[model samples]
Target chain A: MVALRRAAGEVGRSVAVHTRARPAQPQLHPNPWDTYHHTVIEPRRRLGLDAVRRGMERGEIRDDLDVELVGDLFTGPLLIRTVIRPGATLEPGLAERIVDTVLEGLRPRT
Target chain B: MVALRRAAGEVGRSVAVHTRARPAQPQLHPNPWDTYHHTVIEPRRRLGLDAVRRGMERGEIRDDLDVELVGDLFTGPLLIRTVIRPGATLEPGLAERIVDTVLEGLRPRT
Candidate 1:
């Protein structure tokens, strides 16, 4: 989980740089989407899904939860800060906070 | 809550259209950021924050949670499907699913 949080934070920071560096005319760029998908989204999604799967196996997460959607829950807000919401600060510990909050929610109700 | 769901869905659909219609040369367009901020981000953030505040008042959501971050969790995934992830379907009930999942995670653990 610590590694996952670190990877997520690193990805968020890199994405911040990537978004800023995007050419104003994306069509002139050599398939930015492909680069973004392969480099950012795919790896991050896989890592998050794996983490969630392991959590389920350990009985930390709800068995019935859709893992893909759970991945989105983890990825979305970070992406919003780094990609969509311009000028929003990608504060430190954000990744950890998000993970903790979602995990708290996902813990099976006693 | 129903109204919030409906509004979120509508906003998601409208954002789909808005993104698709954006001029490739955004610099040539008239202050696209301003338009996007005013039309989409600000209003949606306000609505989500208001709903979360009401939930807190009702003892539904964790009062300690940052309402803005909670709003980001709801908005980010929808934006991911509609705006960030090209070729991803903004399927019906996506808004409801996101809302429900986040709310489930958010419900005051008692």
Candidate 2:
């Protein structure tokens, strides 16, 4: 949970910084989507994947889990709020709530 | 689970249709984001919320679960793949997998 929280926090902070730096007008680029994926999505995805991997190593997560899908579950909702759907507020502790909910679901059952 | 599956399938089909109809170039609109929210996001979100409500009433989901967050967990991963992250493939049975995984976690414990 701590690793996941750190990963989520880092991604949230980076995205917040990026959102603030974005220009009002949409900029013309060869492929803004690709650029965004390379710059923001990929790195964050790696962070999430790493967190999930570590959790599995510690026997906190299920051994049979799909690592990528688990990562998406952790970050996708928060990402939608921050990037895709700007109207939704990133309330305090939203990331932690997301992490807790997903982890609770994903944790190994006795 | 049936209600949630129906809701998810409807949202996925509608999104597929919308994606096919979208122009190659980004269209000029006064508020495309708001338009999308009204036309797509809002309606789909409501469907997910309804599904969660129905699950609770049926005793399939926990009574204390946050409907909105649970809804997000069900749909957010698929949404990111289809709409936000276009490169990812929406493989067959992906929706069902997401639904089952989340439902397993959220279901009432005896």
Candidate 3:
């Protein structure tokens, strides 16, 4: 009787452990709409922040740009509108904002 | 006396005509400074106006851009800052002005 009881206890413990086990973490693929839906690009959110961070580390942006970020990424032209439409252009003073965003995005994720 | 007078008159008239013969027109190579010395570019003055005119002829801008210019040339990005300085960017509403300049430059020289 004791042996049977012990076996049941063992089985119960095994089931409990299994119920508490961690589930698989899903791999993240950046969606294009989620990635580039913004009129201006956000490098970090888009997964291209790595290059900006690398560039910041390399001093390309800080050298001529009079500034530096946590990483070595160039925040300026790293995200210029590749195609400014015929009747449209970015608002005045927005380039600097884009530059700032690109640089900040390059900051090493702690 | 009449023959002598006629000969002298003919010689004078001929000499005047020789002096006044149309001066040779100089071949113009656009000077870089002359072509693009402004804060914003002027397409016609730059000697690149020909391309703009051709683009206007093709109707490419009118079809998609909601507007047509003297030339099919796109005045917008065609004159964007190839490099916006680190501390710099264009002023407000200047893009449309640049577009206008590019279009006017494209107007066929009648």
Candidate 4:
């Protein structure tokens, strides 16, 4: 989880740089969707899905939950912060807050 | 909250329809980012920001959290499911799960 959040922070920083670099005509650059999928989502999907599968194997994550969905949940907020709410500062606690919310949802329910 | 979730479901359905109709070529259609902002984000932003303000005034939501940030949190997953993970079914429990997760995060922790 720590590593996953660190990756998320890195993704956020990369996106921030990309966004800042193109304030005038965002569309003139390569499609952000393509850039995001190639640069961020694919790699994170591998790492996050692997992590979730390991967690489930160790009885930390619920086995029934969709690993892909869990990956999306964990990364979605960071995506939103960078893409959806571009101007917002990447707060120090934002990654922890997002990771906790997702982990809480993914944890095996008692 | 019920109304907001209902609105989200509607947005999901609309996006699904849009996606299903455009299986041949997505970029040929209007920029989904524009469509999303105009058709979905703008209205939802208005309604959601209003709700968050009321929630904050009523002392249900913490004042410290950014209202726009909260709106993004509540809606980001749906956006992801529809736009980011377009093929995934809108699972019946998806909305509740997302809302519950956001509410848990927004709830004042002791």
Candidate 5:
């Protein structure tokens, strides 16, 4: 859970910084959304997925989990709160709460 | 799980249909993203959120869960798989898998 929180927090903070910096730059592309997806979104997603997979390999996560789907499960909320949802700010314990839910979901059932 | 799957499937299908029909119409505004978010995304999110809350009230979900955050958990994947992920197609059992993870997380732990 700590790793999950740290990884998510790092990505979220960087995205916030990037968006705040965007206004200073002139519109460089007719399709900025596509560029944003390829450059910003995709790499971050890959990094998060890698983190999750590493957890699984370390016997921390379930081996039966679908990597892509589970990757979305973690990445989706971070993206939504940080970008899609309006007026969303980095509240205290935000990453911790997300990681808690995920850990509870992904923890091996006894 | 069935309710979750049905709700997600309906929303995913409608979004797919709407996007397919978009290209034929001339671009009406410079910022269609905002319009799309308001018209399509927000209401769908509310509906999904309502379902989770209802589940909690009925003792199907954990009473202590955060409603808005849980709503994001349910709505996030549907949007990601259906809209954000490029070349993503609606796969069989996708909604079931997503709901299974959520239910496992949200179910009152013994």
Candidate 6:
């Protein structure tokens, strides 16, 4: 019984000692999804999405050319007013009609 | 009445024309918070927080020197093993005691 116990302890000790003596591998960088997630999606989604959505849903109902949606809300309204910012129109109905048409384009294809 | 209406229309038209003729201001870069938001906080929180939390909470309760807690949940376990991973110990209790101490350190500073 003593011999069996000591042998087991010795085995565990040796395995521990061996592992402790080894050096660590360095963490690799420029990891694939990290690059895309950080550069492309994260910032664009984190900041831009909320900003655009807020502008569209509130106040002046501003709009954009840059629809960086994850899925496809690709075709949304286009407003020269908000995009142009403190922008103007030649005729009032001209801008409104353009906006309505752009919005209609976004409807899911039936 | 006609004069009053015409004058109002003319005011609106001229204001519109004037705004359209103006040049757009270049988007200001290096907006103070933008730098910190993009570089300092966002990336750190987005990747490191999730990774460290996952590594610690899951598989092995891995730990760190970088306790960048927003409010301060500092002082977590120290692992020579999972941190050193596939790692081992001279004495069984050594790692456990150290981990317990580190964990205790995080206990609300109380």
Top candidate (lDDT): 1
Q: Give the alpha carbon lDDT tens digit for every residue of A1-110 in model 5.
A: 46756886666455544543332222334277567767876787778788777777766667677788777776566556544554676577776676678667532344
Better of 2 and 3 by DockQ: 2
Candidate 3, residues B1-110, lDDT tens digits: the string is: 22322332333232223222312211132343232323222322233334333333554222222122221122212221222111223344333333332323211223
What TM-score do all the candidates reach, one by one? 0.79, 0.79, 0.18, 0.58, 0.73, 0.18
Q: Residue-wise lDDT of candidate 1 within A1-110, one digit each (tens)?
A: 56655655565455545655655665556587677668766775676678677766766666677777776777777776765566787777887787677656522344
Task: Report how far residue A104 has shifted in candidate 6, in Å.
Answer: 3.9
RMSD of each: 3.8, 4.2, 31.3, 6.8, 5.1, 30.9
Fraction of true contacts kept, per model?
Answer: 0.37, 0.23, 0.00, 0.15, 0.27, 0.00
Listed in order, the DockQ scores are: 0.41, 0.34, 0.01, 0.18, 0.30, 0.02
Q: Report lDDT (CA) for all predictions.
A: 0.66, 0.64, 0.27, 0.56, 0.62, 0.28
- Positional deviation of A85 in candidate 1, in angstroms? 1.4
Ranking by DockQ: 1, 2, 5, 4, 6, 3
Candidate 5 scores a C-alpha RMSD against the true structure in Å of 5.1
Interface RMSD of each: 4.9, 5.8, 23.7, 8.2, 6.8, 25.2
**What's the lDDT of the predicted structure labeled candidate 6?**
0.28
lDDT of 1 by residue, B38-101 (tens): 8866775676678667766766667778877877777777766655566677777877887777
Candidate 6's residue-wise lDDT over B1-110, tens digit each? Answer: 22322332333233223333322222333364354435443443344345435444442322432223210111111111212221322243332332232232211121
Task: Place model 6 in a CAPRI quality band.
Answer: incorrect
Q: A81, model 4: CA deviation in Å? A: 4.1
The most accurate candidate by TM-score is 2
* Clash list (residue pairs), candidate 3: A52-A73, A55-A72, A55-A73, A56-A72, A56-A73, A57-A72, B55-B72, B56-B71, B56-B72, B56-B73
**In model 4, which regions exceed 4 Å deviation?**
A1-4, A7-40, A54-64, A81-93, A100-110, B1-4, B7-40, B57-63, B105-110
lDDT of 2 at A94: 79
Candidate 5 C-alpha lDDT tens digits along B1-110: 46755775565455544543333222334267567767876777677777777777766667677888776666566556544564676677676677678667522344
Candidate 1 structure lDDT: 0.66
Superposed on the true interface residues, model 5 gives a C-alpha RMSD in angstroms of: 6.8
